[model samples]
Target: MITDPVNRFIEALHCFPALPRVFNPWFSVDPEHDASSLAPTHRIDNLSRYLTERLGRAKVILIAEAPGYQGCHFSGIPMTSERILLGQLTHKGIYPGDVLSGEVTRCSRTDGPVGRRGAKEPTATVVWQAIKTAGLDPRECVLWNAFAFHPFDTDMLTNRKPSSDELRDGLPMLHQLLELFPDAQRVAIGKVSKGILDKLDIPTSAELRHPANGGITAFRTGFAEYVGRL
Candidate 1:
């Protein structure tokens, strides 16, 4: 069981157990443009705290196919890259001066997101856009991925699909998360992840369109219909 407290897992994770042989682009963040975007420096706890503190009581929970290159896997944010966070801040009415508030815990160092070079999670631009497009808010839904940690197949940094075993292994954590939110509904993106929902006994609607494909269009059109049912 991969049920260790998120922080314990980070401590136990070998320094680059499966680290990349060379620096990968997915791990790099241009801070000038990226803002606070930096790679995850074994900061799973930072993300776990953020999720619990801000969205623990959300009504809907989004389950992405897998962790993204610059966002979840690298930056330790569930879906918070600088671009995404900045947007989230603006959308939530937060400002640059507000970052130091008691709302979010500050992070230190970048995790070798792609080998030792480090990597950042997806920008808030992408994450916030997806959430806005979905028509959700902090009170409306929570965010998550099937795999808590990032996974990759090659040094090229291509995001890999979660395998059957990977999904199965993550089942416990998913269950634990759902149990934390009583009103939460599930939104599984990608066919592979949709199947995991039922297998984990988390009831949800049909599989959502993978964001990379044309699912975004169908999602927009059907968003009203789904919310109405809610």
Candidate 2:
């Protein structure tokens, strides 16, 4: 049985059936095809352990829509991609190898070229950059998604917006996170996230634009405003 709250949280995510065919960083492993798929759990677990140590400290919770195929689907950390997983981001404390051994192969996307070592997702880059630009310490915040799992299109390579039913299923895990960090101020990172929070009756400190498509500038501006208020 998992005793620690952090591990238990991971366990809860592992058990949730957000989609019929899902890639769970906490439990699923594809050794032959992509061993790196197995590394996200370790990366996320290390992050949880760090957050556990910072319990009672003033923190912020940033909730986004859901994991992107090139982001949390592999890194297991929201607002992060494989580049961040390999310690390429300014915040290296959440590296996948921090708690696990062996080299993690950088898996290529279905539409991407092969042999890529550190691929980056545009959204991840923008989110992290916005966080840094806002003068917020990455360690002082916890990032998650309203829908914790990746929802793909028929191609399974392309990302699709999660359905209402899927988002509803993910509510329990979000609630579990809130139970663990009751004092942390919550911030929804997009319309979907804010809508879900509203449905759950969970109050938030702010709602920032999501840094995707052409919303990078708006995202940065909104994040800066939120940070300025802090």
Candidate 3:
């Protein structure tokens, strides 16, 4: 979905670091997990190695702040929120039953029950479900994040919004991700991405009123007319 010779594009990002799943909860990320959330051992040479090995080509790249404290920050998979994983399943091609049935990793975990507060952050299923609703293909969609590593989690345990300086420092990876999907139309998950879009001169829209906002009816009402054009 990006370009001819995907390796070359991945190679150009040789400076980036890749890592094994680091989400053990005891270990910390800094001075260890680089912006790529990868250990020092991982090289730029393996950029396409993981996803290419796992999912395949992704044309659309979804943007998010970073991983949840319990998810990728602990595990190293970008946007690895268990709630979002459930979302992907509910969408066509993937399902909650099949996921819990051991078809997928069964990573779904939530702080609160469904229809209540504290849903898991960005599980793969919710994302895929959103993509399905958006009328897009997962094989054609490449997923990544602004920081790739989660930075903030005090006693609150809520993921911190990355600072402007962090975003400024961490943005090159965003560019690399952009290069990974030349045809992808970027989507901003939260407010911070406006600056990223401004840096790249790409336009973005505001966050839609999410299901958490009782906006599900509006989503069903008008989303089809909007998604791909952005």
Candidate 4:
């Protein structure tokens, strides 16, 4: 029996065939890659551990639609990217040493054409910026996704909305995640996330606009308002 919530969550994530490869930072190498590129696995593990630590003190959870190709797809941590993994961004309540242990290069795909490396994800930037702008402590909140995996189009680069079937398949993991934080209030970040919660018959304390496609202002305002009430 797995005693750790983080370990159990990761294990449950692995059980979903429809879920894309979930990366963690503990391993030195990417299991999906041959020997060509150094894996970002360690960075992912560090972030996961950091998240778990934060969850222990969290009063609320912000749930988004899903991970994007340029964000969690590479970092393995939702609402985070390589910049956060490498300790480039200095935000209150987030330290490099807490999430990253040692030096590790970012991972790349050895099987297909190489994509951009170390690129900052726009949505991730916006989300973190909003968090900081709202004066919310990272330790007081947990960030997650309704669908944990990146849903990409045929191009394998462009993001697409997660299908209903995909959301259905991911519901069990979401349920398990909620179980880990029974006392924390849930805040849906977008309509997609809110819809899923509604389907699950879960009541959310608040809802915020997603910080994408020109919704940054609304996202910041809504988030700040919600945090103010907390």
Candidate 5:
């Protein structure tokens, strides 16, 4: 019996629709990107363990627009990358302990687009930094995405905004996540995420600019003010 909230949440994620050009990190396997045949299972384990460690400790739910190829596509955790999970990259005050109790592994092929372990998303780095600046432990915050999958065009390496219809596929999992962390304050990281949250009647504590595309400074400023309150 999957009675654990984190386990149940992961089970729901496994049942998500397999949309075209959209990669479900917790289930999808890309020979071109994955390091081995077990990469998909590894991703699921990563997410399950991550959520398990933070269960009942989350104070905020940071919802971003969508997963990026260099970010959640490899890490399983939203707004996070392999480098950060593997302890290759660490922020000052955030993640002082092992992200997954020393179980983190590289799921991306070494020769993949970003090369080496896996590509690191600038936005992921900034998000962690913002958390550190807020003086909050990483476990106190749960990072999620409006569209939990990586949406792309013809090229798997590139990222694209998910259409409304595609975003609908993420609704079930999103609702499940909110239900899992009902007490945590919701914070939207971009306009798209904020719009979705607003339309769904989900109250959000803050709607800050995304740290990508030259919005670093603005995002840092906005995130500090909003997340600081929590």
Candidate 6:
């Protein structure tokens, strides 16, 4: 039996209904491309440790749109990449130590075209950089997404926006996280997240541009402003 609330939350991800073209990193493994049959289990362990470390300490929660193929789809941690988890990337003291705790293994094969170092997501780097730019401790913020799973239209490797139905489907887990950090201020990382948070009447402290699709500069500015207001 899972005793830890964080572990139970990690396990709850496996309960999400299997959707076509959607990938659940904690439950599903790509037969043709993943590292091994145990990749999903490894991801589950990694995320469990991450949330366990930050449970009641997070002061802010950053809600983004959804997990991208290059990020959480393999790492099992939202807005984080395997390379960053593995201590291969760093900037201004984020990641490696503050963002992730315990061991993090790559769910994707090292021999693939992404190379032996594993995939790195630019969005992950930019988001962490924004936190540092805002002069906030990375550990004080929890990175999440409206849709926790990776949704793709045709290719599992390519990222696509989650539909309204998908967003609604993800609410139970989203609410679960909020409950786990009841006092943390919610910050939407893009229009989609802000729209959903607004519609649900969930009070949000700030809404910043998503650091993807060429919005890094704007996101940094908004993040800094949000921190300044704190």
User: lDDT by residue for model 6 over 139-229, one digit each (tens)?
Assistant: 6789998788999877778888888788787889889888878888999988888998887667888888988788989999988888787
Q: Which candidate is the best by lDDT?
A: 6
Each prediction's TM-score versus the true structure: 0.63, 0.81, 0.55, 0.80, 0.93, 0.92
Each model's lDDT comes to: 0.50, 0.68, 0.45, 0.68, 0.81, 0.82
Q: For every model in order, what is the number of clashing pairs?
A: 18, 0, 23, 4, 0, 0
Kindly list the per-residue Cα lDDT of model 3 for residues 118-185, writing each as its tens digit: 13444443454555667754455555666654556453245566666666665676675566556656
Give the C-alpha miss distance for residue 164 in model 5, angstroms: 1.0
| Most TM-score-accurate candidate | 5
lDDT tens digits, residues 46-103, model 1? 4555555544457777677656656654345565553233334465443322211134
Task: List candidate 5 stretches off by more than 4 Å.
Answer: 91-98
Between prediction 1 and prediction 3, the one with superior lDDT is 1
Better of 1 and 5 by TM-score: 5
* Candidates, ranked, TM-score: 5, 6, 2, 4, 1, 3
Indicate the residue-level lDDT of 30 in model 6: 75
**lDDT tens digits, residue span 166-211, model 2:** 7777778888888778888899988888988898788998998887
**Each candidate: RMSD to true structure?**
7.0, 4.1, 8.0, 4.2, 1.8, 1.8
Ranking of predictions according to lDDT: 6, 5, 2, 4, 1, 3
Per-residue lDDT of 105-217 in model 5, one digit per residue for the tens?
Answer: 68988886767846787888888888877777778888998878899888778899988888776788888888988899999988888998887677898889977778899
